[model samples]
Target: MLSPVSTDSNHHPLNGTDATEHSVGADLPRAIATLNEEETYRALLTATHWATLDHAYGSAAEAPKRLAELLAQDQTVRTKALDYLHYTLHHQNTLYEATAPAALYVAAILPNPRTTRTVDKGHNSFPGCMRAELLLWIASVADAVTDEADVLSRRHGFPLDDYPPAVSIRRIRPQLYSAAVAYVDDTDRPTAEAAITACIRLLDDPRLLHHRAALVPGIRQILGTSEQWQHRERAIDALDTWGEDSTGLEGQQNPFLFCDSDTPTDNGSRPIDTNEGYSEPPPF
Candidate 1:
């Protein structure tokens, strides 16, 4: 396992327990604040860093602004943010120094209720579907990192040091994991499905797969219910993939094996929309 990166005295590592006990959304501001102070993060924010870092559009100068705009209240703004992220950070499955932090920011914002609210009263807003898309993008980036790392290790004939971007992600795995779990239970079907997809893709990383026991129950819950047909199918697909590689889980009542793809309802009825008590994102 990689050693935890050292942070200042005021900043604490976001372990699984802290994530469980506290709201991941509530903790995002502090996490971003702490990240801002890290040397590598600070470098990524600089104009010089953007000028030197290559992206699909030649330079990554817009990366920092786009990262900040991901928190914007406007649906258009957030969509643009996703576009910029997709075009630059991991364009064509290429990772950069900024890719990891970009992914971290994506994970940090996932559970923020402010980012998940649908548009209302003509105010610009983020939709649950968009948030779900962002989660999918996050999953893609994580999978790309694993693929790239493996290729490099094989070619170099030695285990490479943790890629800088991945190291940044490792520093906050607990927070990401916590947010993902919270998202899986989100009232919006697409958002929840997206979260499940993210969780499944993240399992591609060996470190995360090693901790699969903690996440398996949640995966089972999704697969065993009628939350959303598409979500359930995605969950089943992810579990099936993981089951193939996971020898330990063999003969342990694989949830995917018994899942009914054609039937939307399982032992329980379809989940009711329970948006009550949830606040909409405040207008900009």
Candidate 2:
């Protein structure tokens, strides 16, 4: 069930800055802080808005509902919400107009500290892996929207005026990238690893390249301290691929070579290739 859109003016605060010029780390939270969840949901999920948007299965009216489900208390419900998002918005590695809006909500939900905490005896109930999966989905949606916008620009010699949602996606990309970078040190291994993966995927965007200085320390920390070999390997790969200077680390002979060939690594199970359009296989 979708939450009712709040009509109160106080609930719909605006950050009062140009989205384009906003700084990364400070901008995402600021923009999110100003948003009214219900109002935003209402604006993005209406029939008039969704009538034009088409997902793999067709109409994307359910996107907002699924997005709302992400905030549900049950971990299973949250996981299903992510799965539905992947199936609909990003099915077959394809992006839809609804993808960007959905990505925004995903970014909004991620900053909550409870989302990344391990299940504990106290108030925290959501599983950390659910947050990790959401990070993967954010990266996938961001990558897909970027690819779509680039393709349109190359073909038309201008921005995507034909698709207004694509423009929104491009505009919000910096904030999305910032949110991912900010969460790189989340205490849970899965959440931190997924955050790193999102950062690596986002490097493909020129707007986020400037964030390299901000992202390096977290990547380095993950490479040096994370218990999961997958997290460490991905961080090392990101550093090497980006040519980031890892000189801050103490004496080490090619820290990049720390991972032996025999060590198994999980190449993030999600299928998020920009060039590939393969549909997900059946679970059987």
Backbone clashes under 3 angstroms, per model: 0, 0
Kindly list the per-residue Cα lDDT of model 2 for residues 1-284, writing each as its tens digit.
Answer: 11111111121111224433322222345555644555643443342245556677778766777777766777667656665777677674455667765676677667654465332111223334657777777766555455544776768775554555555565666656666766676666667767777766666666666666667777787654566556566676667767876554433345576643222224443433233322345222
Number of the top lDDT candidate:
2
Which runs in model 1 stand beyond 4 Å of their true positions?
A: 1-52, 118-128, 147-175, 223-234, 244-284
Q: Candidate 2 — what's its lDDT? A: 0.57
RMSD of each: 12.2, 9.6
TM-score of 2: 0.62
Best by TM-score: 2
Model 2 lDDT, residue 57, Cα? 74
TM-scores for every candidate against the unseen true structure: 0.56, 0.62
Per-model lDDT: 0.50, 0.57
What lDDT does model 1 reach? Answer: 0.50
lDDT minimum window of 10 residues, candidate 2:
1-10
